[model samples]
Target: MSPNPWWQDRVVYQIYPRSFCDSDGDGIGDLRGITSKLDHLQALGVGVVWLSPIYRSPNDDNGYDISDYREIMPEFGTMADFDEMLAAMHARGLRLVMDLVVNHSSDEHPWFQAARTSRDHPLHDHYIWREPGPDGAPPTNWEAAFNGSAWEWNEPTGEYYLHMFSRKQPDLNWENPALRQEIWALMRFWLDKGVDGFRMDVINMISKPWRADGSLPDAPVVREGFLQPAFAMVCNGPRLGEFLQEMRREVLDHHDTLTVGEAPLATIAQGIELTHARGGALDMLFQFEHMDLDSVGGHVNGKWALKPLDLRDLKQTMNRWQQALHGQGWNSLYLSNHDQPRPVSRFGDDGRWRVESAKMLATWLHLHQGTPYVYQGEELGMGNVAFDDIHDYRDIETLNHHRVATTERGQDPAEVMASIHAKGRDNARTPMPWSAGPKAGFTTGEPWLRLHPDHDSVNAQRARADPDSVFHHYRRLIELRRQHPIIVHGRFDLVLAEHPLIYAWTRTLGDERWLVACNFSGDTPVFECPAELAGREARLVIGNLRAGAGERVDDLQALVLRPWEAVVLRLLD
Candidate 1:
């Protein structure tokens, strides 16, 4: 058997294709645009590039609504372009992992089209369809992830179909054996092309709650009249484990693949079971427990209901995962993704302490025991865009929320806009600021979405030139991980667990030990070294402070840290 997949210790960089770079002058990013940026990935020291969906799509839900499983999106380029891109990645010693969105398919897809045309169609059972209730209401009071009802009426079929996301993206019926076979075939199609693996989008949501009598249970009402979120009604359903295991046997077991499942709302024990090496379904899991800390009632209020990030709460969450997954499975570490706002804006200070805070966040994430994911533009200390106009936003989720909040709920538009500015997914979808030129050099033509106004100050061209840029700090962090085996296989223990602003942790492997500490605020904070490490000789392996990349100290009893200052010290015992 393979000792461990190469992706175990490699850092994965996620590229949101549409906003990464636009090479065709069509104002949209394509395969050629991504190929042009291979050198950047190589220099950044990331081993794997997780390319977002480029499959044939209708652009509804921005390529997540896949219409054709085997073809590339015309706007993104052709099948030939995909092949060339893959070859270029391999030549540079970089592995490519494609996003696997099997939970749903575009309404325009042949199967969905045929399924919706008539109730007697052979493909009708390929999707989940249900007769309306006696009052002509939807089958269940289940809300889609984006907004509105989870069930959409099919006029021709005289029934409503399930859509956990947008109406155009209908959820697939996994209970069908034929559907499973077809999915397995598509998996082979890409793996045969030599791509590394898959990042299953909402993989746990495939096996939704289906009763023995063929009825989907109604979601519990959070409020009196609103259609409640179907998070519990559909997510992590009974057959999730069985389906994943079947997928492994049919597709993953045949290839040396790297599988990371997006398992929202999963507990630590569930994560461990899903990613177990022997009988498990995936190699890693993206848990949202840490991401949910700031949101009070996330499923009910959506992500817009924001709260301040408590360093102590963050420490507890991370410590639990790190300590639990030490030997059972692996963690997929990330601060933000394509569907979330920039980390600098959310977790770190994006204004007064931008670069320092970005570097500090990177240090905090990479210092732990997990495969770190660098979303596109994250390494450059990019922050959220201040799009004052709702027209400037492009995400369906954001637009839907604005409509519901203002028109339906009678909410103040300005207050709603503030929430959008804080938690909008469009914040992460801004065009990559490659240079401080017109359109930030992302495109020679008009960009599909408005570029961040601050792109002039924060761009890759400038960050790469300055040694103190967050880009270089990330490079150093990745380099350290590659060089030190302890960083990958070490056990983590939280220090100063109760500190409100000072987040500190230690990693140990046999006789080797390393201390990592960071001040999460603008105020200077002192990290009183732990008793075991106090008075021990230590060298600053890497730091975000202005002048301490390799400084040494004989005694480590107490050290003052600047605002957002982060330090990694190799305890010389």
Candidate 2:
């Protein structure tokens, strides 16, 4: 057997600190709230807790815009509260992974403040600054991910700075050796404080392409209203590998920690190089290919418009990643995070067969060969919220797109609202439902965002007590990963890759083989054993529903599956 690291066998749970739990009734979650909820996470059987950014910020892009990396946000708590929370998590045998937002810092950060004051400042080269175009327009025809131009003009300085995201965030220049050392020192400080790992946000965009004379030429415009695509030059730049390898040699080599990069437009080949064990770059990367299967116009249209998802395309995308990275690297499996809508609402049936569909998705993702990450509230089958009006939306991305679509594009307000309702980041940002009490047991005061109304019927308190709840189903899946080594190291083979409604695959390790099958739709589908395992005896292992005494068939025959039903069986030779 190949030796595996501690993180390889463990599961990660991501917690958005602002919406997790509120302890002081301040309408926002705090560090003390996270400390009080350690027992809940321990009971859920997750080994790693990946917390979103809790650092001092201006709240422009939630917590992603960091003003101070060393200090905790006053709303979240003080340094003392962070220490207490970290101690509590370690005491419960749970590892903590912090979100590293070094791709860009808030405009209010000390480094940026000093860099923007004058051209001859000591930290002037810390951020990317450029002169206006020949026509006195922005530096380049590049657009930010959150809409608008990528370059923000500084009236006091007479130069523009680059911002791939919002204007409040200024991109850091990794080409500066002193700035790189400063980041290394900050990482060492956190490492000494006992942080187990880091979830690097937009780490791929740190190194940007620049001309020999430091000139940024305009990109080819693709659309009329939209700016040219800048990711081609911003992502996976020339010096990315050098910077990551240098970081590994300086700060990460002596530590036993996990690192995952949030790569937005990375391809499979890029993922392989970034995560290769010998490359010394990162442990794994979160690619956005599978997430865009339902997008109407690909990356340009963003996630606002939706289209029908083709099962064949989905299977091909996932299979390519699994096969390419089989022995060279690792994969991070997930369906939803703070940036996207809920998986149950987007991919599965969230209305009538919510429970079954949730379990089916868990089975389909966990049975693959990789490390699984469970977002908060996903285990309980929590779904998207229904907001009728645009006023109910609070996400900056959603509001910005709504305005651009309605006012700039002359689209109907009702049509924009419908798209926002179907695909909005706020769908995954609602407060976690702890109980049936007011505010869904999230806070004593008004929540930062509204709670889902269905929390009354679907919550932790009720699910924990019921034996047949989605929470328990997830627990069983986690246990299986811990007990079966094959689930972790087995070779993946796609089965029924072209099926329209049913998804199936197999994992094999020497003499042992396991089959995982699921129905994606509400209609009953017929499942047939593949020809390769036609004569093998099938033994029922774990399933969503228990089979009767005579219901277990040993021969390869046709069997009908219920809506969103998932089953796992071992084939004995």
Candidate 3:
């Protein structure tokens, strides 16, 4: 394998189409709206743009439940708009990677629609199906990610079909060779249309737990009255490696495309098998170990049990991936996505030091040893939205959790709202703040989802105009990765690991050693350089504070950082 792939040095920016911009002003973001903003991405210095699903869907999971593989969702625009968007991206030298949601298809999809008709239907095997118990009960105690039983009763067929998510989305049966071919053909269709690659949604869940008797097994109940997450029964199943490798061989191998899968509970060792550079299944994998640091109790209770972000635990988790995947596999560095809360609100201060903490967090993630991903509005420092009323949220996951928690578990409504405020996916689904103008400049009419409450203060116009805004900071970080090979291919070693208020690390590429430090709290923290960088000449690559953006000669041992400050210095011999 070559030392540096093109993807390794470039940054990937994600855009949830519904929240980006509304071109038609019908209250939803569309494909043309994305085409209009190609300049924003080119200006941001991201090489690749990862678009969330714009495929035909019932929107049960906010486009995660795909209904048609060949057509665009009418709310998003037509196929012509998609073609225009892709061409516009390429014209600006930007590559577009579409979200591929093959783990499940909407029940409205033709295949599933036909499959549910009867057991004798030709497409009956297209989706997983099973007979109910003797008394006509659900197949197992497994729970849907959105709530209720994993198996939904199909009256026409007199059987239950598997749906790990919403019942509207039935899990596709990869066990059927014909169904696998159908998926590959759809992938080829997009590739032929000039798409650069795919960001596979929950690709690990394509295969389910199967017993020797050819039946899906039930997961032991962990929470007494509640159904288990069934994570063990759903993710990284036995045939996962075979399926991924086959995918690479059949379709991905033919094109120079970026392939990344959403791996929910994948360990570092397993992550290597799926992404090893030579003879590996994928170019990279988005692992969720680090994302779990601040939470416990998986989706059975909507994972609403919130915990404070522990910097040390984060430090350990990140460094583990860094060391483990250094050469064996690859890593995709991201702090937040459409499925997670806004980074600033979750990890940094969204109240007093929004800008400073936003930059700090970006600096921390981008300087790591992998390709970095930037979620929409992250550069503008948009924090999470705290919708006081549950009616405002459009996310199925958040809505389901709120409903089940308040009614079934008898949890307090206010407490449930607090959890939603902290970890709800709706926080990331809010419309992007393009301007301080009315409607946040996202739409001309009522927005499909609510806009950020502070859009007036935190908009792209405000950020781009300010030299010290988080937007410019992110741009400069991307510039650094492009210009300096060390930032992309360096070895990582964490420093000040025990420091509660500071998260600092060193990166080395041959003789090039750099010190990257971040103050993770609201209080000022003093960070000392590692022994090797104690007296080295300091050249500032980037920093959050305006005064520290250029060359510096401060003593490394007593360097003082302001609240939520971050800096990266190239130590010269």
Which candidate number has the best lDDT?
1
Residue-level lDDT tens digits of model 2 in 29-55: 888888888888888888899999999
* Model 2 clashing residue pairs (backbone): none
Off by over 4 Å in 1: 1-3, 223-228, 546-549
Q: In candidate 1, which residue pairs clash?
A: none
Q: Flag clash pairs in model 3.
A: none
Error of 1 at 233 (Å): 1.5
lDDT of 1 at 550: 66
Residue 190 in model 1: lDDT: 98
Off by over 4 Å in 2: 1-3, 223-228, 547-552
- What C-alpha lDDT do the candidate models reach, one value each? 0.90, 0.86, 0.88
Ranking by TM-score: 1, 3, 2
**What TM-score should be assigned to candidate 2?**
0.97
Better of 1 and 2 by lDDT: 1
